[model samples]
Target: MLNPFSIEGEWFKGNLHLHTTGSDGKVTPQEAITSYAAHGYDFLAITDHRQVTEIDGLDHKGMLMIPGIEMDGGQTDLNGSYHMVAMGAKGPMSYDSGWSAQELIDYGNENAEFVFIAHPYWLSLTLADMIDLEGYIGLEVYNTTCHYGVGRGDSGPHWDDLLARGKRLYGFGVDDAHFGYADAWVGYTMVKAEKCEYDDIIAAMKAGNFYASNGPTISNLQCDGNKMLVECSPCWEIRVVCPLPGRGTTTYRSGHKPPFTEVEFEIREGTDPIRIECIDEVGNKAWSNPMWLSE
Candidate 1:
């Protein structure tokens, strides 16, 4: 596992999924970029539905603008379409409307720097449906629009189902914002890259050198031998999650207790890869990429 915390770089905050008036969003592309840049975002992707939202020669407000598109196809178990977000693609993007999810993933991998399934929980995807699929990097563990709009945003359990079966996929939190309500800046990914340029940010992201969060900041994380160390902003709960059910533990702060900024865990050997979660008092969470012990 290549951990972002173990890498040497400045943290760059960005949202991998978002929409503008180019598709179904309420705001224009410039307005969307302005919102993120005004809020201190270092990079942004305009993932408009089925179409490339061009930022060519447009004012980006000094932010790195990545071209992106969200594709919809492939029937799910719930009789719904599969949604995949792809960014950093080269020229002449085209696809068949009847392409299967796996085919879409193959095309995405062939064209873009990276791709991921979007809102599996919202679409009712399961391990049986996704276990055999290949080429996509990961799925959205948390979506601002899905949570606040439909109460089905958190897909950590879906992610765990894959992890338990040795899938080894990454987790991402994104704001799939259409600007209908309070869904613009709620969830995002923090990438560790040497610079805010396109190559550096995309390289770090494709290498899984990042963390997903809506709130709280993870300052440091390391696993040396069987011992684990985590340093983060004040949090109400800290958890080390292993695929094995009984191997996990939770540390929490009660009423009137001081929030925890750091924690340690002595994981029993042979648990393999484990991920960390930091939850603030209000229930917003930050998720670290998995740390593998078996490697």
Candidate 2:
């Protein structure tokens, strides 16, 4: 399926996970919304710690504001932690630490548009810890704060592992911006929606009509049978990744040659859900949602 590309609509840039002075962030709600709006963000969610941060009266500066919250509770298989980002809620929620991770996930899925795991690599979450959780939309494939503060940001492997094991999930990239470090404007989810309205944006996101990016742009992505084509900004490498090793291919930019803007690959047989990655020269990357041929 060509998905968002073939689905129709305008591309809207949004940051799903963000913090403000209402939580542990340095900036106030006004500052956070104003800054993001000024930075050309089409939409934003104020996912403060444990609360949605009340956006009704905020100026929002003509930008679409989605209600969100980030909460950590429950013990994992390794007794680690579970952090969840919940969006599209009409009100804030409170949960005791006594709740299990599954409990939080179930609640979010029931009450919100959808919820996602926040920074799986940063939390050191294992495949075992997350594989059983139901109703989660996906995990944070890239978190700006986690990368800058702890150097454990990228969660591509975590996403790959889950996909390989037959878990259908999307990926999200967010700033998780606290401003304690330079995190904002570093990561985003580009959603293709028919309008800038709140419901349309959330509906598009719920449908996975989007891609996660730190810098690179994925202008087009299409798959026909076993053959896939991706059109992106000039990048150093374009890789076709499969669940099984040796079934994928990578095209690297020739030294001193022009960067490649497009690449096509005939996927190996029976690769099921095919995924692709585009990596720019400076290490910035963009990821496509997994595509299942069977679907």
* Segments of candidate 2 deviating more than 4 angstroms: 253-258
Query: What's the C-alpha lDDT at position 152 in model 2?
Result: 84
For candidate 2, the per-residue lDDT at 107 reads: 78
Clashing pairs in 1: none
lDDT of each: 0.87, 0.86
For each candidate, what TM-score against the reference? Answer: 0.96, 0.96
Candidate 1 local lDDT, 1-295, one digit each (tens) = 5678877889999998999999999999999999999999999999988887778878999999988888888888777888998878664467775899888888888888888999999999988779999888889998999999999988988998888888878888899999999998889999999999999999888888899999989998988888788889999888888877677666742233448887877778777678899999899999988777777
Q: Model 1 lDDT vs. the true structure?
A: 0.87
Per-prediction backbone clash count: 0, 0
Q: What tens-digit string does per-residue lDDT give for candidate 2 at 218-290?
A: 9988888777788999998887877665567778422334387977777777877777788999989998888
